[model samples]
Target: MKVRTEMYNMFDGAKDYLPVGQTTLPKLYLILFLIYSGFLALWAYICNQQRKNVDKIHLVMGVLLLLLTLKIICALEDKRYIRNTGTPHGWDVAFYIFSFFKGVTLFTVIILIGTGWSFLKPYLQEREKVVLMFVIPLQVLENIASVIIGETGPATKGWFRWNEIFLIIDVICCCTVIFPIAWSIRSLAEASKTDGKVAKNVEKLTIFKQFYIVVIVYLYFTRVVVSIIGAKVNYRYEWVAVAAAEGANLVFYSFIFLNFQPVDKNPYLVLHELEEDSAASAHMWEENISLG
Candidate 1:
């Protein structure tokens, strides 16, 4: 009886030193995200195996999904630690690194969808490529700044100022790619005639436009709404919302992958190849049956 009472007193004392917050919701969302990511990875593997030629887009998307899954896991684990100890140590840096890569992969996915590789190469410029290359590096710098600020003052609370700055930069970068892609699709849809091939192209672009719009909305929810709420309320709750948002985003990407597998069958790729083949055949026939 004496030992049990002493142990209980010690446990009570330990609780007084622990951080305060509920972890159940964050944990639940993390589990869901993990399961979703696992399924997506399996689907991507199957997609690659079924294809006559391996699809780079699908492979890349799969890898990105896995990376994002790792990011979420690291983030939640870090949060869990913070909740228990009132401070983050190692997992904090791991979370930031995964976050950096996830952002880069997301940008790559957007580029792949906006411009089918061979046909749309002419539309993209060297400068745009350079800009894309810099996004991850800039994000890395931002993370470093955030960490330095966070550790120097009230730990995570010190990041409030940097968070807002980073949010603005993120919005700008997302807009640069998203708005132009939306505009280009709209232009294509308007220019397309009501013929079979052209109509098919328009249909595909319409779907792409819808997907892009949803993505923009999701971005707004994550970057704007969550940021605002986190600033006003507890950051832990904000993480719960973020986990849910990320899970939904994963679903969106999965839908995109399922609907647009094999890349070659995509209407844009099909039409472009058809036109190129027709032109080649026409030139060959003219050469063979020349009329002088």
Candidate 2:
């Protein structure tokens, strides 16, 4: 049996166009670019029509989608360069740059959403801020390892070290993302008993549980299942593994946007703030307490 690929002419003075095991990348990336663009546009429309309901968290989601779209375009261009010249000399830098920002923004959105920030409340806990502080630096190192791994191939002495570092950091980040979700579920369960909003808390608990499950499934598929597939597959079928990973990503991002997109809500339920007169009275009480 023979698999036909787009091989360059022998007289063209190039060894190969697309790299081995990556023949499908251009088409895959192009399609993803279009799909991501559609998501970005749809999210933008939803936000525009519901302008009064928009919040900082909605802006973060939009940024995540925009980053993903730009990242895919960079990937497409890089693949095109690879297709024509057998190298990603110039375009891979852009891809990695977007890749870094995308990773950071993605984790920010994930952690914030997991804790119900700007949806259930307007503030983050100190511990949550600590998570963000660490994640940004970790993302930087992850992308650095990725670029090094890609540029050095498997031949360099430190290639194995970088690969291990990349995997460890990735697994850490994946694990980190789920804890906040778990915390939210537990908090909702406990709050239902104490907050005098049992029904509301129960509804949110169900949503949080569903979100936790989605995150676990998404991470397992992308990290564990995809790795197994790539490891077991023939080198020639690497494209299949890549496609599976990207497809999972597309689905994951789409689900996040759909599940959590902004909509009009009762201000009291969403913000947890007192009515204006009550708020003013509370402020006076606080001031009197402080003065006493």
Candidate 3:
């Protein structure tokens, strides 16, 4: 029962109720908020430079970054409030509200990325839409369960129940996400056959495969590795687990944004204006030649 409880290590003979494995979270979240704020600014500049080329997906990523930054701010304040008062209250509610929305928005962005929606294509296939319909609802449920778990704390039976529900929904969403990435890769491979753009399609396929690998790594590290760390660390050093999970999250977000940035040459995205111009020019040349 001791190990099962969320233990708060003593500091100078006084119990700290800020939650074990998360005492450093306030500082961590502060740092994360600053980092994401900077990232959001840089992202805005990049999008501005390529305004004509950016799409809904590109803008969605910016929104995700903003949500993350704001959520980090709220979380830091809430944790500080808890550390001082021995309980979650006011700001805690705001934190969870932002957290829930951020999670759902993140899931939507990831789903869109895996399906190549708004980046590589303007439309979604029926199966891809179905994936969205199912996974988005599951993500919503997972977020709800996470909030309940957070409010109840890990020591309570209610927390245990909600945590289980959270895990089940999270696992389902993870499994569901993989399908779209795999489908995109398969579609690219098939397109390479008859599209007469073998080289380009192959490049796209390689990018998709790499994205898939990164997604798997991100999920594994954040979910499994972080849990393992929390369980294995000494009681006093529980903050390490929080740091590990947050660090992984920061890296994962940075990678996704950079990899799929709205640029003319980002192989992860579809070619638009420049390619269309080239094809149009080629067609005009052929027409002129035939007339002459």
Candidate 4:
């Protein structure tokens, strides 16, 4: 009789603690993220090990996906805890850490894609590396500040906040990357007119450029516009919108990887090298004839 009474009391307490009107969408998104992350990690490892020459961009992208997967998982766990316990916990800190790393990795992937390995190497050695190092730390510091100053719960007023300001800064950084990417695409197009090899390579790069632009648009819509809507309405299910957006982003990334599987097998690799060799040979032959 005593044990039964105790069990009944515990059950009642748990019932009382359960969050009101909690939805399952966030949890569903987390499950999807886990599956995708696992698949991507396996795929990335196979590509890195099996390929004759592994592409650095693939490796970086794999790392970025993994980081994002971890961030989502942590965020999901944090949300679960809050719903069950009606209070914040250490999981929130884990979410923040993973989120910060994911952001950094995302930017790194963008830079790698925008410049390509050949150009990125020298650019990183000169000015870009220093700028990135500073920017990442500052962005993290700003996020921490926003957390401290902003409301603990969902935004109840306008979208404009210290955090939103940092998001604008991030948008500007993405815009800067677009300029370089656009220039590279234009240069490739011009070179393609005379060089068939360059044309083939340009086609491959165009696919990547299209993917990048789509992702940028998605980011702006979800990260900026959705945030504004959630804040203005103080939606009870704001996390659902965020989770849905992230799930969509992951789906897009998965589609890209599926379409462009195995970087080593890309025709661009061979064509790019051939074009470079041809250019070098032509220059050398011209110099020799002039000297003779």
Candidate 5:
């Protein structure tokens, strides 16, 4: 009887200490899924009309899907179903260290976005400039929140379900980049329409487009993996991995923009002028030779 009573007491204690399950997230997930599906349908329509215009939209949608998947899996893991014991023991300290670095990484990306946008303001429309600026601060705040929730682990086992908000922000911030990128694709398409040879070279000109999509997809999946582990093992630390991924993303975008050129009006004029000048100079040389 004594042994049975002790076991019951332990069970009761465990039950009492267990983290609270999310009461509202399921509804939010349903809503998010519905909204995302609607957007996907819209993207499909756009793609049918203009393939280039939809490329960035589709890419961003994929990233959002991956982030949402991560949030859902992590939430499920936190409930301790499926026997998932997240990270190994003695990992909490390491997790915190990573979180710090990741926070710094996120902050750095925000700065880059801000500074880059400021420099690009002359080229971008006012609305695009404003949206880019808005997303920078929001993304920074979301990263800060992630760090705070991560550090709260090993105690109550869960924060205020902040990951949900972070996921939403991720979707929005990624879309900020997506909208501009999509515009670029449309610009490319228009340029191609004007010149048959340039249109034929579309494949070459847009080579970097695929890389942008691939990097965003990679980051999305990594974030999901970290979220699942954080929630499953009661270990909420994703700073280092997240930071490294974001750093890679920063570099990738830098490369993309560096290689991006205005493909419409300037190149043709410059090439035409060079050809005419060369022809005139050659004619003058031929006349001098004939006279001699």
Candidate 6:
């Protein structure tokens, strides 16, 4: 019970240092809720606009988005219990349960998003392919981190060390995803300068892409550096730093993933002009022109 009290004090100390006028997990939860909700709405809109039927991937993502929302709620409950009981160890088993759910929810989301992006290769340019390849590994790393988190327990003696390892992997993934995308977007922007309308769409998309990438990177570094400092300073607010680090991911992914969809390939676009001309001449004067 004494350890529990100390843990509550730990939470209080962390909460005190949160963005002045804000509670720690609750604030983060509210923001995440809004972000995910917006994403769900956007996905629905995209689904409606799709010319063909919604595929299994879209259906899966829709389901995952809902589960992630539930995870936010569970995280809020954990935060509340910790705040009230001051026990970060485990509260009647809810701790492990919540951690497991959060891990699974996030892991599923990251994998699905990455998989969906890869499916978009038909529509992606060569530079996009490079950026995507770099992103895929990072996303896999993040998923592995989540799996590790789910396997470890808060009260386990070596849990913190394992968690730290997961965090390191997470940071690596976030950095890889960010810098590669940023560079690719910059390249696309520069190349598209002479093309007008298409260029404008690319530029607009690039802006948000760059913004989210930078935001993810900034938050990742901020959380990582603060955690290192917190560990060194023996600060009572170390959990706060951890929360901040995790929060960065929650926000960035929720925001950016909404705009991602599985791109369809245009078979016609792959044909050369010469092939098109030949096909046209071959079809000339024919009642029904069909390519075999």
Q: Which ten residues in a row have the lowest lDDT in candidate 6?
A: 1-10
In candidate 3, which residue pairs get closer than 3 Å at backbone N, Cα or C atoms, i.e. clash?
A: 21-238
lDDT of each structure? 0.61, 0.81, 0.79, 0.59, 0.44, 0.51
| Candidate 6 lDDT over residue span 46-160, tens digit each | 7778737455656666766766666665556555555555543443245344445454444444433332333323244565456556655555555555555554567867767
Top-TM-score structure, candidate number:
2
Return the TM-score for candidate 1, rounded to 2 decimals.
0.69
TM-score, per-candidate, Cα-based: 0.69, 0.85, 0.84, 0.71, 0.40, 0.46
Any runs in candidate 4 off by more than 4 Å, and if so which?
1-22, 118-138, 149-161, 194-196, 228-236, 259-261, 267-292
Candidate 2 to truth, TM: 0.85
Question: Which tens-of-lDDT digit does each residue in 1-292 have in candidate 4?
Answer: 0001111124455422223323454466578677867877787777867676555666776777777777777767665665555444676677777777777777666655655543223344444465466557666765664554433433544435655666666666656556545655665667655554543546646755775686677667766777676566444565555565766676666665564455554553344666657765676676689899
Best by lDDT: 2
Instruction: State residue 145's C-alpha deviation in candidate 5, in Å.
Output: 0.8
Candidate 4 positional error at 41, Å:
3.6
Query: C-alpha displacement of 28 in model 1, angstroms?
Result: 3.0
lDDT of 3 at 148: 76
Per-residue lDDT tens digits for candidate 1, residues 1-292, read: 0001111124455422122323454476478667757776676777666676445666777777787778777777766565555555587778778877877788777766665432334445564466566665666665665556544544556566776676666766677667446655765676554333454456557766776777777777777776576567674354555555666676676666666566445653345666745655665666679763
- How high is the lDDT of residue 19 in model 2? 45
Off by over 4 Å in 1: 1-19, 83-89, 118-127, 145-161, 194-196, 231-240, 263-292
Evaluate residue 217 in candidate 4 and report its C-alpha lDDT on the 0 to 100 scale: 78
